[model samples]
Target chain A: MKTHTLSSHIISYVLLFCIGLFLVTFSIYYYFTRSTIQETTKENAVALANNTVNRIELVLNTEERIPEIVAKMLESSFLDRDSLIPFLKSILKNNKNICGSSISYEPNYFPDKGMFYAPYVFRQGSKIRSTMLGNENYEYAFMDWYQIPKMTQTPYWSEPYFDEGGGNMLMTTYSVPFYTYKKRERTFSGVVTIDISLEWLTKIMSTVKIFKTGYAFLISQNGTIITHPNKDYVMNQSIFTIAKENNQPGMRDIGRQMIKGGGNFASADFKSKWHPGKLWINYKGLPSSHWSIGVIYPESEMFASLHQINIILICLIVVGLFLLSLFTVKIIRKLTSPLKHFADSARLIAAGDFNVQLPEIKTQDEMKELYNSFSYMQKELAEYIVSLKDTTAAKEKIESELRIASEIQMAMIPHIFPPFPDLPQVDVFAVLKSAKEVGGDLYDFFVIDGNKFCFAIGDVSGKGVPASLFMAVTRTLVRSISDKEISPSVIVSTLNKSLSSNNESSMFVTFFLGVLDLATGELRYSNAGHNPPVVIRGNGDVIMFEKTKYIPVGLFEDFDYGELSLQLAPGDKIFLYTDGVSEAENVENKLFGEDNLMKVIGENVKASPRDLIHNMEVGLAEHVKGHTQSDDITMMTIVYNG
Target chain B: MNVLVTSSNDYTIVTIEGRIDATSSNEFEKSVMEVIEEGNTKIILDCSGLNYISSSGLRVFLIALKKMKAIKGQLKLCNLQPVIQGIFDVSGFATIFSIFPDQKSAMER
Candidate 1:
C-alpha cells in the first residue's frame, strides 16, 4: 500500500480524481480558446487601423490638389478674363467642396518648399491672382491660407480650427506658393489655397464596429479627446475636469498616465454614478497619428459559463455519489447474506448435529456446492462413526465368546504336565491356543490302557467356534479309537470316516495321531494330509517325517490314512504339530517354518518333553517376533524310555 | 440619497453635479481613496445642493476624513442640510469630520 495524505484516503477520492482531471482538461481547452479569440481580435484591429489611416491620408491629399489645379489654370498668361471666368466656374461646378478658388501673389515671400506648390517669390508685375467669387474684392495679403503659405518655409497640416467667415466651417486648408517672371528674375507670389471641412473626415475611422455596451472614442497624444460621440467634450477638455466634476475614482490618475503610457489594453476600476467599483477597459493608440481608441466591457459576464459549469458539476457529483453508495450496499448484502447462513450451518455441523441443514440456494454456484458438500460429508461422517462403534461392540462380544470356547476346547484334552508321574520314563506336554477369532488347532496326550499312550495334534481348516467344536469331536474320537486297541492308521481312518459322515458344509481337519508302546519304545503316527511330524534320533539329529498323505479328515469317504512308525531311543524326542504352528506369522510376514522348528527340537532332543516344548516355543517366538500370528499355533513333544 | 459638493480651488471651479446615491457612493469613496493615495489629504466636499444623505453615501466622507487625520492632513465638509447633518450627528461622525459653510471657508481652513 502506498502512503498518502490523510485527506486523499476516502471512497470519494476516485470521484475527486475524476473531477480534477475534468477541470484540468477543461482549463487547458479554455486557455487555447481564449488565446485564439484574442489573436483574431488583435489581427482585425491591426488590419483595420493601418488601412483606415492610409485611406484617410489619401483622401485628404487628393482633395488638396483640387484648388492648385484651378489656380494653375487661371494664372496662365494666355487666358483672357472671359476664358478665366468660365474656367473658374467649371472648376467650382466639378468640385462641390470648393466653395471658392483663388489665384494670388504677394512679393518678397518664401513659402516652405514642402508647404506649398509655389515658393520664394519677390514682387513682380503683371500677376494673375484671382478668385472666382469676389475676385477683385481684397488684396491677397489679407487672406489667411494665401498669406500664411507665403510667409512659411515648409509644408504643414494645420489644426482643426473653426472657420466662421468663409464658410462658418471647421476646416483644414491646403495652400501653394508660386513665382512669376519679372525682369528675368523669379519673383515671389502669393499662394493659391483652398479649404476642406474637417468634419467631413469620414475617412478617419471607416466602418468600425464596437460592442453594444462598449464605447470607442478618440484621444489626442496629450490624452485630450478630440472627438467623442458624447457632446460634452466639444472644447479641448481633458479628464482632469471630468474627474473633479464627477468625483470618480482613478479618473485623474488614468488621465495623467494616458499620454505617457504607450497605448495598450488596460483596465481601470472606478466608482461612479455609471458603474460602482467595477470597470472593464481596453485601449490602443495610433502611433502615427498620436490618437488612441479605447473600449470597455464587463468582466463578470466573461466567466458566466464557468459559474454555470460549477453548478452542473456539483449536481452531477451529488447524484453520482448517491448511486455509487447505493450500489455498494446492495451488492455487499447480496454477496454476504448467503455466506452468513452457511456459517451458521457449519457451526451446527461442528456440534455433531447430523440432521443439520443449510438453506437451499437457488443459484448453483460455488457457495451452493460448498453447502451440498458440507451436507454430504456430515451424513457420511455420521454413518461411518455409527458403523465404527457397532463394529467395535461386535468385535468385543465375539472375542469374549472366543475366550470361553478356547478354555472349553483346552479342557477337552490333557494339557496337564506330568500326567503320569509314576511313569518317569515317559514325558509329554502339549499346548493349544486359539487365535482371537477362535480357531481349531489343538494337541492332547493320554494313556488309553496299561502301557499304551495316545497323543494327537490336529488343525481345523477354519476358525471360530465351529472349528473349535470340530476339534472337540475329533479329539474324543481319537481317544476312543486309541482305547479300542486300534492301530494309529486305523484310528485316523475311523476318525476321518466319522467326521466326513453327513458333512454338508464340506468342513475338514488335518489330523495326525500317534501310538507308542512303552516297553519297546515304538511310536506309531498316522497323518491325515497334515504337516509331517519331526523326529529326533538318538544322536541328536532331527528329521522331519515329510511323508505324503491322501486327504484330510472329513473331506472324503473311505479314505485310507497313512501311518509312520518310529522307535524312539531313551534320549530322543518326537515333535508333532499342525501347519498353524509352522505357519504362524508376525507383522514382518516371516513364518515360523519347519526348518527353524526342526533345528530347535534337534538341539534340545535330549531334554524332557516339557523342556523340549519350552525350547520350541522360545525358538518360534524368537523367529516370529514383532509379527502378527496368522493362525492358531499348537505344538506337542514326547520323550520315550526304552 | 444623493451627495453633492461644489468647490473652487486655485480658481478652478469643481462643481460636483448629480446624485450620489448608494450606487454612486462607491464612486464617491473611490474618488476619496484616490485622493488619499496621492497623499493629498486636504480636501473640501461642498455639499450645497445635496438633497439626501444615506449611510452608504456618508461612509465615503467618513473614510476620507479618517485617512486624512492619520496622515496629519485635514478634510472639510462644507454645506449640510438638517436631515443630512442629523444622520452625521446620530452616527457620531460629526465629531470626526470637519465641516465648513462654503468652499472659500474650507480652503481657508
Candidate 2:
C-alpha cells in the first residue's frame, strides 16, 4: 500500500553493495600499485646515478693515469723534457675525452729546466698547443695542482676551477709527483698533472635522464656542484650555498651526507623559487674523485605513473558502478513486473469487478504460485456473487407472487363499510387485517329479500392462499344458499354439507351467520365453532351471546346446527369478530381476550358502528403495542336504529 | 419445520414438527409427495409436534390426499393438537378425511 517501489529498493541496495565493494577493492589495488611504481622509480633513479658516476670516474681515472705513466717513463730514463713536450702534445691530440694535459714541475725540478719552469700542452680547438707555465703572475709551483701533490707526495685531484693559465676552461687537474734516485733514497720531484675539462662531464650529466623531468648533477668533495643541468650554478654554487639560497635545510643535510661518501635515496620538500614542491633525490658517491652524483626529480614527475593509474582506477570504478546500477535496475524491473500486474488485478477486484483477466506466468516459482492463487480467488468470488444474485432473485419472485395473491384475497372481501345505505334501520362497519400477505378471515353481508338481511363472518382452519380460497368458496356457497333458504341455521347447515362433501385437505372454518328482519326487529344468528358476538345496549351494558355446542362448518355432513334469536331495541349494537381479536397478543404475550373486547365495545356503546369499530381498533392497537400480529383480524359491527 | 417419516406394514407415518407456514409448506409437500410417489399410499400425518399450520400447509395435505385417493388408498391424520383440531373443525374438514386421536386409532382406520 505504501508508495515506494520494490524495484527501486532492490536496485539501490544492490548498487550500493556493488559500489562499496568496487571502491574498497579499487582503493587497495591503487595503494599497492602506487607504492610499487614509486619503489621502482626510485631504484631506476639510483641505477641512473650509479651509471653516471661510473662513466665520469672512468674518464677521470684515464686522464689521471696518463700523467703517472709519463712520470714513470721519465724516471726510467725513457725520455727527456724535450721528448715529453712532443709526447704530451701527442697524448692530448690522441685522447678526445681529455681537454688537455699539462705537466707542471715543482719549481723546475728538472735540471734542464730552470726553477718555476712547467711544460703544458692543451687542445686549442682541434689543435694541440704546447706551452710553458710558471710566469710572474701565474706561478705553477704555487698552484693547488702542483703544491698539493708535492706536499702529499702522492697523486691527487684538484677541485674544479677555471684554468686561466693554460687550459682556459673549467677543468680539474690530476697531479702525480715524480721522483728520481739522487742518493739511493726517493725524493719528491716536480708534479706531473693533467687538466681535464669538465665540459664533457657536464654533457654526460645532462644526457643521463631519470624519467621525464629527472636529471643528474655531480658535486665535488667540498660540496661544490661540478656539473649540473642548470649550467649557471655548475662552477659557482656549492650544495650548501644552493640549499641556503632555496631556504631548504633538508637539501643541505642531503648534500652533507652525499659528500661523506654515503649514498641515499630520499625525498624532501625543497622549496626552490623555481621549483616549489617536493623532490626525490638519489645520490651516490664517486669512488675516484670523492664526488657525489645526484639524480633529482620532482615528486610529481617521479610518481606520474601512479597519478595516471589513479585516474584510470577512478574512471574504471565509476564506469563499473554505473553499469552495475543499470543492470540491477533492469533485473529488478523484470522481477517485480509480475507484482505490479498483481496489484493492478487486485485493484480491479476490490472495485467489485470479478471478471478481470489476470496475467499468466509460466515460471515455476513464487510468482507463478501467486498468479494461480489470484486466479482461483477470482473464480471463487465470481461464483459466490452469482449464487447470491440467484438467491435474491428467487426471494424477490416469491414476494411478488405473495403480493399478487394478497391483492386477490383482499378483493374477495366486502370492502365497502356500509352495506345498506338506504336502509336506515341498520348502520354496519367492518375491517379486516391479515397478519400475512393473504389471510383466511372473511366477512360478507347481503340482503336476501326486501325484509331480511343476512351477514356472516368466518375464519378458515388455516391461513394464506389455501385458506383464502376456502373462504371464497364458503362465502359463495353461503350467498348462493342464503338466496334459497331464509332460516339462518338451515343456511349454515346447508353450506357446511356442501363444503364438507369434497374437502380432502382436512380444512375447516369457524363461522357465524346472522339474519335480521327489519319489520319485527328480530335478529337470528347461528354459531358454528366461532367466537360469540357481543351485544352492547344503548345504556352501555355489554352482553356476550351464549356459545353454541356445534362444531365449525365444512367438517361434518348432516350435522345439527343451533340458532339463537335476539330482539334488538333501537340504538343497540352487535359486534362480530374472529378469534384473531380475542387472541391477539401484546409485547408480554397477553391476549386481547373476550373480556377486553367487551370492555372496549361497552365503552363505545352509544357511538356509531363505524366509530365503535374504530375505537375497538384503537384499543386493540394499544393493547398489542407494536408487536407482530399473529393472525388475521376480521371484525364487523351493526347498529340498529329502528 | 422438520419432517420425520417412519413406515410399518402398509402405512408411512410422517411426523411433522414446527409451524408449516407459506415458507415451510414446500418442504412439507416434498416429504409427503415423496412417500406418495413411492407407492406408500396409506399414510399417517402425525401432528403431535406440529404447533401450527397455514393454508399452504393445508394445500400440501390436500395434494397428498388427492394422490392417495387416486391410488384407492387411505390417508389419515392423528395426534392433532387442540389448536390444529380446532382449525379442522372450523373449516368443516373433520368429516371428509378420517382423523383419530392417536396413531393407533389412525392406523386401525
Candidate 3:
C-alpha cells in the first residue's frame, strides 16, 4: 500500500545491483591480492636471506683462508718465536676481517720458555697491539682453539666465545696445527689461530629488514643466537631458549633445521621473542662459518600494505556507489518528467476541462503512446460534452412544455371553490392530483339550474397524454349533455356514446355523475365502471352506492347506464373518487384500500365538505408515507343541506 | 407479470400470473396480441394466479376484448382470484366477458 516515486524505485534497484556486484568483486580481488602479496613477500624474504648468507660467507671465507695460509707458511719455514710476533701483528694489521692472531708452542718446547707460551696480536681501535698471552692466569694450551687442532691434527673452527685470556673479546677462532718435519713427518707443535670478532656479523645483520618490523638474525652452529635486532637476545639467548620462552615449540623445529645447515623458508609459522605476532623465517647456512642467517617476517607487518590497499579500494567503491545512486535518480527523473505533466493534464480534464491541452511527446515510446491516448480522450470528451449539453437543453424544453400543458389541463376542470355561491344549499369540494406532468383524472361541478346542481369525477384508464386527451373529451361530452331535464343515466349514456365514436385507442374512463335537488335533498347518480361512492347521513349512518350497471365509458357503442337514487337527510355527504384513492401505495406496496377510505370519511363525517376532503387528502398522504403517487388521485365530496 | 399461452384442441389458453400494473401491462398486452395475431379465435384467459390489476392493466384487457369482438372471436376468462374478480365486477368487465369457474368449464364453454 505504500507508494514510492519512479525515480526512487529505479535508483534503489540500481544501487542494489551495483552494491551486489561490488561486494563480489571486492571479495575475489581481496582474496587473490592477499595471497599474491604473501607469495611475493615469502619469495623476497628467501632471496634476501640467500644474499645475506652469501655476504656473511664472503667475510668468513677470507678469515678462514688467511689463517690456513698463515699456518701453512709457518709449517714450511721455521720461524723463531721472536719472529712470530711480527708475523702475527702483520697478519692482524693487513687483513681487516681478522680481529686477532696468535701462535702457541708446546709447553717447554723451548727449554728456556716457561710452561705456557703464546704470542698474541690483536687490533685495539685503529692500532695493533702485541702481547704474550700465556701466563699463570691465561693458559693457551688448555683452550679449545689450541687443543682441538692439536688433538685432530686438522683445521678447526671454534664456537664463538669470549677470549678473556687472549683477545678479551667475543670471537671465533679457526685453528690449524703445524709440524716440524723431524724424520720427514708432519707433527703437532702448537695451534696457529685467527680470531674473528662477532661484531662484524652484527653489523651485517643490522642492515636487513623485511617490511616494517621484519628483521634478520644470525644463529651460531650450536643454536646460540649470535646477532639479532633485539639486543638482549643477541648474546644472551639461544634460538631454542627463545623459542621455549615464547612457548613456540614450532620455532625449535626451525632452529634445529637452521643449526643442521638445512636452509629454506619455513613452512610452519612460528613466533620469535622479538615480536608479538606470528612470524615467517627464511634461513640459510654460511658454509664457511656453519652459522645460519635467518630473516623473520612478522605476518601482520608483511600484509600491512595489502590491508591498506583493501581499505582504500573499499572507500573508492563506496564513493562510486554514492555517485552512481545520485546520477541514477537524476536520469530516471529526467526520463519520467513527462509523466508529471500528463498527470496534471489528466487532473484538469477530470475537473470538467474537456478541452485541456496535452503536452506533445517526441519519443516514440510508452510516453508518446500515453500522450496520444490522452489527446484522444480529451477530444472525445469534448465532443461528448457538446452533445450532452444539446440533449439536456432539448429535454428541458420538453419538460417546460409539459408543465404548461399540465397547467392548461388543470384549468379545463372546475378548480374554483364553492361553485354554487348563490345556492348555499349545497357544499362541494374536490381535488385532483396527477402522477405525471399531465394526468387523466378530472373533477367538475356546476349549477345546472336554479334548484339543481351537477357534479362529476372520472379517471381515463391508462395515463399520460393520450389518457389526458381522452379525459378532456369525456369532460366536454359530460358538460354538453348534462341538463336539468335529463336523468343521470341518460346523461352518462350520451357521454359514453360520444366517447366510443372514434375510440380507436380502446381507452376508457371510470366516470361517476350525480345530480342533487337542493330543495328536496334528493340525489341521483350513475357510475360507469367506477368504484362505488359512499354516502354519510346526518344520523351517522353510512351507505355505499355499489351499483355499476355499465362498463367503463368509450369501450362500447351506445351502452346504456343505470342510475341509483338516494334520499339524503340534511347534512348528508356523498363522496366519490377514482381508484387512485383506494390503490395509493406505501413503501411496502400495501394500498390504502377502500376500507381505510371509508374509515377516514366516517371519522371526519362531522367536518364540512372542504374540511372533509382536506382530511381525506391528509389520510391518503399518511397512508402512502412518501411513496411515489403511482396514479392520478381524484376525490369529490358534495354535502346537501335541506 | 408472466403470461403463458398454450394451445389445447381448438382454443388458446393464457395463464396470467403475478401483478399486472401500469408498468407490466405492456408485456401482458404483447403476449395476448401475439396469441390473437396467431389466428387463435378462442382464448381462455386464466386468472387464477393474478393477484392485482391496475387500470392500465384493465385497458389492455379492453383492447384485447375489442379486438376479439371485431374479429368475432370468443374470449373467455376463468379462475379469477377474488380481488381480480372484484375489480372486474366493479369495472363492469364481468358483465361483458364470459366468466367460468375453472379451466375445464371454460374449455367446455
Per-candidate Cα lDDT values, in order, are 0.62, 0.81, 0.84
Best-to-worst order by TM-score is 3, 2, 1
Q: Judged by DockQ, which candidate is best?
A: 3
**Roughly what TM-score does model 2 have, to 2 decimal places?**
0.55
For every candidate, what is the interface RMSD in angstroms? 68.1, 5.4, 1.0
What is candidate 2's CA lDDT for residue A626?
90
Candidate 3, A219-243: lDDT as tens digits: 8888888887777776689989987
Model 1 error, position B92 (Å)? 99
TM-score of each: 0.43, 0.55, 0.81
True contacts kept of each: 0.00, 0.17, 0.67
Predicted structure 2: lDDT:
0.81
Give candidate 2's error at residue A254 in angstroms: 1.4
Relative to the real complex, the DockQ score for model 3 comes to 0.70
Report the first chain's TM-score for all candidates: 0.49, 0.62, 0.76
**How big is the positional error of residue A436 in model 2, measured in Å on the Cα after superposition?**
14
Stretches of model 1 off by over 4 angstroms after superposition: A1-331, A357-436, A447-453, A462-466, A479-487, A516-521, A537-539, A546-550, A560-564, A581-593, A596-631, A639-642, B1-109
